[model samples]
Target: MKFVRTNKDRLVLISVAGEIAPARMRSPYSVTTEGKVKVIPVLGGITYNVRVGDSAYGWEGDHVEPGVSVMARKKEEEIPFMTLPCIGNEVIVMSGDAKGSRGVVTGKHGGVNHVIVHFDDEVLEKLMVGDKVLIKAWGQGMKLLDHPDVKVMNIDPDLFEKIGIVEKDGKLHVPVVAKVPAHLMGSGIGASSSASTDYDIMALDPREVGVEDLRLGDIVAIMDHDNSYGVGKYRKGMISIGIVVHSACVSAGHGPGVVVIMTGEESVLVPEVVERSNISDYLR
Candidate 1:
């Protein structure tokens, strides 16, 4: 990986959880395959114990969490939380009981613009929705020096180092839990960029590669996927690296969501499957 300097002005300190809104539904009357109207927590609360790759249960829509869910002050600030903080970025509690405690950016929720951060169990006990957290916020506009064709998206430089990436045979070799095919990519496809949203893993078939085994925080590669400018359009010879953010959903064109971390054209990325590849293993 190569480093490119970005303007310092792009970096900003953002606050968290300005309001504790009630859990929402995309469609209040939506029903699951079981013919039951499913309602589940979506934001602004500490969802205990669940980690990356866990099932989202019967919930429908984005920002579903198995852990703490942190949102920006309001809808206007959603863009910063979604696009600025990269996976593995350091987050510091700025106020409330957990003040001064630190955590790691774990994932980004699609559609709702929520960012999930993980702290130690003890710290979580003291955390509150009104507490403020600060992010260093410096990952946009970075690129690979060796591979110009590859585009880095929403990845902090320091966080990227911890992802266990290496260069071999003139291609970037990334350690990932699973290798996903382009056809399985569901919602959020064709978007202009991945900075603010994520694509879904349409895990309709259990036998598909990496679909059944996906875990939250797992790094996976989408073959033939392109997200040069936040959009997830498909093309030959392109690849996108992402992390599992939310759990699997029963909705059509929806399953586990993977937020784009890094992407590049063919010859820029190659993925190697490692059984234990998960964000928790590295961050925790």
Candidate 2:
């Protein structure tokens, strides 16, 4: 698309470490929206069944993190681990049986503050809790020179190039799986930044909108939601594109969370719904 770069040489690289977190549940039972209490596998560990291109719905689990969920070893290092690694960054296993294995940063989740990584099923089988992984974080300060109005964040440069963003009439046309209404946005509303944690899409009725068939890593468009200048807020005529990082939730305020990759004026940030909008299509 020949999009211009603001300052290609100035983008700094960050390195951080975190371990595979063990699967955890707040209590023995979690309340479902249907007024039933049950125990289900939630966040953390290596998920064998679910993956990047798999459907986010129809799981017995609640707020499940696909693939491997990682977090810093200590509380002090949590901020850097969560904030530095942007979506699509490279991750290398540094400890345990999976050492030397490679993966890609899928996205991050809020509240629990975990980063999700996608690896082959073979690698997932070898991964275990307390295993360490190093991340090569390099996608924080990118901006589109030709379409400056369209803000970009939390995405690696290589993946950005593969996003299929086309420029015409001075506007950026981004590919998305579906267009999500502003009202459907439920959790993580007033966050200070979109670089670290993610916001959720409330799916009270999954079939009510087109998100029923959404999959992890699918890029979707959020209407009237602005992430320009850090805060995730609602502004008239604004739109944001994000990746579904986690599974659909049974919790009232949570659902498949989306980490923003790009945002701008609706007029300039056009969404082109296509058959393929998942990041897995861009990579292996």
Candidate 3:
């Protein structure tokens, strides 16, 4: 069955499913319906409305996808503006309508889910629990990936916008943006949302490593040196796309975690890249 939503309101972040897809499942999940067991496809791996009867449950380890709604942790702080992180990290809305708002960051979950920040008590009192937020994306090396020349495995929508790609001509036109050799990507792909504080790069292209170059809302591809996606043998070709979940950090065996990218149509893989476009510079 197809999902129903306005084309403009399409989702980028999706939660994980307990039952694997046909390809991922050694044994798929099913329930007895009448006499036959049936498989269920939980959309976005989550239920938008939380209820006791809901099939989904919250997990401490699960993170929020960027661009999703979040409320303030409390109502004490004073935020003059609605804040969005350029890099994923814990934040407290210091001022504005959401002032005194605080939330643990669930990392960005969808293409539009560029910065997922969770909220707590104080912030919740002053703000609604789920409010669509505006983010300011800045920094360098952020761009779009287009062209049939590469392979992309598992992706969401937010990364698509970050790369600056627009669908046309019955094919995706990924621009020639900057690329980080698969060898340079850290071994642990998922780890920290606050790269600025949680982890650090043991090694990075001195040219590409820096806060100015990597900022919030930037789409990037992790070079798959081992061809983990099986695009082929150790060829310098396969690239796994993901949005930077946070800034560079020094997490154990992990640097910056990425909200893995995915494609909505056709089983085609496209390379991801980094580019700069946020005019607000985190002010939004």
Best by TM-score: 2
User: What is the TM-score ranking, best to worst?
Assistant: 2, 1, 3
Flag the better candidate by lDDT, 2 or 3: 2
Locate the minimum summed-lDDT window of 10 residues in model 3. 16-25
State, as a TM-score between 0 and 1, how close model 3 is to the true structure. 0.36
lDDT of 3 by residue, 52-147 (tens): 111111211122122223322233211211122323233455444675444433343221122344343344445433333332322112222343
Per-candidate RMSD vs. true structure?
3.6, 1.5, 17.1
The local lDDT score (0 to 100) that residue 14 gets in candidate 3 is 22
My TM-score estimates for the predictions, one after another, are 0.84, 0.96, 0.36
lDDT of each: 0.71, 0.86, 0.32
lDDT of 3 at 17: 10
**Candidate 2 C-alpha lDDT tens digits along 125-217:** 898889999999987888777767777888888888887887777778888989999989988989888888899999888898878999988
- Whole-model lDDT for model 2 versus the true structure? 0.86
Residue 247, model 2: lDDT of 90
